[model samples]
Target chain A: MKLEIELIYKQYVDYIYGFIYGMVQNKAVAEDLLQDTFVKVMKSDIDKIENMKAWLITVARNTVYDHWRREKRKLNLMPFIRRKRRDIDLKLDIERGIEKLSPKLKEVIILREINQLNYKEIADILDVEIGTVKSRLNRARKELRDSLEG
Target chain B: MNCSKIEELLSPYIDGELSRDEIIRVERHILECKNCEELLKDFQLIKEKVRGIEIPQPSLRIKKKIIGYARPRNYFLRIIFSTSLLTGLGALLVLTLGHQPYIAEEKPKEYYIMKEERTPYMEILYETEGDYILTNYEGGSL
Candidate 1:
């Protein structure tokens, strides 16, 4: 309710949305989870939070993982396809490549490249050591190379 | 380190995350190794492709929907709490107060079962008043 928190929400809403949308690849679900993320932040005691951005990303990442677990049970019977819109089709191809990544590698690539979070930020979000974050990122890059090439 | 070691570090090297010493080693190795040189080209190609791909913007409807959820966070939670309280009270009332009217509305039918406890003894025969009877075991006059 404070002016600062409201301003923060307004400023970062789009960035958080873009980051989550990149992970989920669905507009409706992404929007729902985005609202959920902000709602959680607003309800939490901010005095305890040292890094708001990393905390928000961590919340968004958990929401995405839960969504994935729920959807995986639904057993999607449809084959993956690049939709007809030229730009979207191309984008969809890139998305498919990201989807093909192992979960660990995918998370690293998404946090670093798509979310544009620094290595230290990603390290905090994932609750891993910095060296582990760097190594995972490197492996992710190599895997993305193989996916794009083959 | 050998070509394999340098090749393993190429991704981190490109990301500018490697230590200064590792950077120098990797750079020196790539200068001599053509295979790793090709690997670097392939890595760059992938990074460019991923970075260049445009991310789709969230639709306007989704934007409005998300904003709608955020706008009523406090009010929505209040409503949920009140509704839950009402639901619990209603259940308590229904459970505490027995369903008298509900049970009264429907009449239960009655059923009976028949059983015999004992049977009477049967009479074997009857004798006329004027008729004389003699016992076979002893002689008698009547």
Candidate 2:
């Protein structure tokens, strides 16, 4: 069991962090909450868990929500210079274009492109139907293309 | 299908979610039609751009920090958990042993007196064998 946790942590911690960072956009906050999410999973009875990856993602999502609830009164705790410069020009442009999208569409794009999640997984994460995920992702991609082309 | 219907299916087509038959129909329609072909190109451009967007490799520091945070030995939570555990144990100990429920360890009896001049003494008027005692002196009453 201990080995399992260590292995899972080693394999997925960075991926989970990147996935969440893409959403939250603040590394420090994402880091703290990522830890909180793992702590939550560790404390939970692991025997009941069937899908560790999905379960971890759900925990991470819930932790983000809880963090927002606790810190809602604090205004914009994100540091200004913390936004790292993009490594690739085109990728950065696409990322910036994604940032310009509405939150709903942006989430779909991030989940699909950045996270590389399937449409069904995106639908599950967003708690929407698969059709909704398809539509939102399509709209997000269309918006990005138009922005870049123009 | 009409142009709008074909356009609506283009996104799913690009994703390859359509059936093989549907793919043939769409391909044939786009091959002959200028407007549908243009729409297909636009969708294709979007897909290419999305696929081209590089996965920004996180720094060693970022990885360290994330792993550090995600580890079980979380700083704040550990402190809170230990402190609460200690407090609960202490409270349990006090409840179970300090204030013995079965023994009836009487609280120290408090005596009040109004003094006029001297320090009044407690005079035992009657005495029992083991523990009980009575006091009757007027000075003791005062």
Query: For this target, which candidate reaches the highest TM-score against the unseen true structure?
Result: 1
Model 2 deviation from native, Cα RMSD in Å: 21.2
Off by over 4 Å in 1: A2-5, A76-92, B70-142
The residue pairs found clashing in candidate 1 are none
**How far does residue A44 in candidate 2 sit from its true spot (Å)?**
3.1
Local accuracy of candidate 1 as per-residue lDDT tens digits, B27-115: 88888889888888887776666666566665675545444444334688779978999999999998878664556767675432222
lDDT of 1 at B55: 61
| Cα lDDT of model 1 by residue, A1-150, tens digit | 444456656777767877787676655567667766766766777778787788778877887777677555432532342233442454555677776777777888777777777777788889899878877766777777666667
Q: Give the residue spans of candidate 2 off by over 4 A.
A: A25-30, A63-91, B57-142
Decoy 1 TM-score against native: 0.66
Candidate 2 docks with a DockQ of 0.08
Instruction: Estimate candidate 2's alpha-carbon lDDT, on a 0 to 1 scale.
Output: 0.65
DockQ of each: 0.10, 0.08
Listed per candidate, the RMSD to the true structure in angstroms reads: 27.4, 21.2
TM-score of each: 0.66, 0.60
